[model samples]
Target: MSKISVTELNKISREIRQDILDMVYTAQSGHIGGSFSSTEIVTALYFSEMRHLDPADPKRADRDRFVLSKGHACPVWYASLCKLGYFEKYHLSSLRKINSILQGHPDMKSTPGIDCTTGSLGHGCAAATGMALEGLMAKDGRRVYSILGDGELNEGVVWETAMAAAKFKLDNLVFFVDKNNLQMDGTSDQIMPLFSIEDKFASFGWNVLTIDGHNMDQILESLKVARNTKGKPTCIVAETVKGKGVSFMEDVRNWHGKAPSKEEFESAMAELTA
Candidate 1:
């Protein structure tokens, strides 16, 4: 597969950010901040870095896998998938509606390209770990990637699964922690105090890398480093702003799960388009 230029990927990410705003604004009930925080990572993976994707055949063997551990941010994931041809653009407006495959969280059975159902935080990481183990055992070259929220690390299960991944030496597994520092209700420190996210993952026996999550260049390079690593799982600690592209919402806790009002939506759209 030919690599998408950095400029193109950046442009695609901007479009995905707009789609995210549109989805949450239309649904009137999606996690916008988290979705925005996740846009670039998803765009980079699907549009540029990943391998063996057949949008027409999402279940194709040998394809790389992505699990949205921070599953509330499915708006961004769905947007990227739609833009990537996994589904139609028209479905973008149906997010969070009853019976819509584009639910508030990703549904593997309902959504064409989703690898696993997620929403209950922490479990997506575990599921990705299992997939990585399966790939390693089968000796397949396929790689598995997962995106997690910093707030979700408060769950003890994440560490348990982290230990299991390292013990099994699942080198094909790479996880990105969207360390935006804020979660619903308050900041990570105010809520759970995620002491040194990089140290925690490193202590768990994984190769750890930290970078500005919003920087496309750093993200692309970090992903390359993760791919080259061996004998253990890798974790990229992505320091990101919660509401990345929009002016008013950046690092704002209220946007964690709030749908914007009409005025706010227009303001957001203005900035996204500008």
Candidate 2:
């Protein structure tokens, strides 16, 4: 597959950001901060890297899968699905509404293009590892890509899955940690210090790569190298701001799960478009 250029990827990222703002603003509930922070990473995956079947045929076993382990920051994933034509753009307005496909967390059954129902932090990666192991056992060539938050790494299960993936030599599994530094209550350091995520993954026997999560070129290059490497799983340490793009929201913990009001939404949109 041809690589998506930096210019094109940035364009898509901008659009995804807009979608996130629109969705959160409409629902009057959702996480916009982390969503913005992860916009570029998720955009590169869904639009440029991941290979899945038609959204309607989401259950097709042959398709590549993405599991959002840090599932609270799911607005980015939701935006990508909409942009990729998984569902109508209008449905995004109903996020978190009763009976809406856009739940507080992803539901594979309720939402097309969602691989697993994820919300409880630090669990999605373990499930993804199982899926990858299954693919290997079945002689299927699909890849499993999972994204976890830096804060979510506090959960021991993430490391357990990491260790398992390395032990199994599940090269088809690609994991990314959004190292935005901040969590819901406060910064990761204040909560639980993380010492060198790259080294941590490398020590676990993963083919580890570190890069700026917002840089399209770097993100794509790292992913390509990961895809080609054999005999071990790959983990990319993606450094990002807690809230990206909008100045006020950036790195603000309060925005972690808060929705913007009408006035705030308009102001944010103006900043994003600027």
lDDT of 1 at 229: 92
lDDT of 1 by residue, 201-270 (tens): 8998999999989899999999899889989999999889999999899989999999999999999999
| Model 2 deviation from the true structure expressed as Cα RMSD, one decimal place | 1.2
Clashing residue pairs, candidate 1?
none
> Which 10-residue window in model 1 sums to the lowest lDDT?
53-62
Give lDDT tens digits, candidate 2, residues 101-208: 989899888888898889999889999999999999988789999999999999999889889999999999999889899988999999999989888899999999
Residue 142 of model 2: what lDDT? 90
The number of the candidate with the highest lDDT is 1
In Å, residue 126's CA in model 1 sits off its true spot by 0.3
Candidate 1 residues lying further than 4 Å off, grouped into runs, are: none
Question: Where is model 2 poorest over a 10-residue stretch in terms of lDDT?
Answer: 50-59
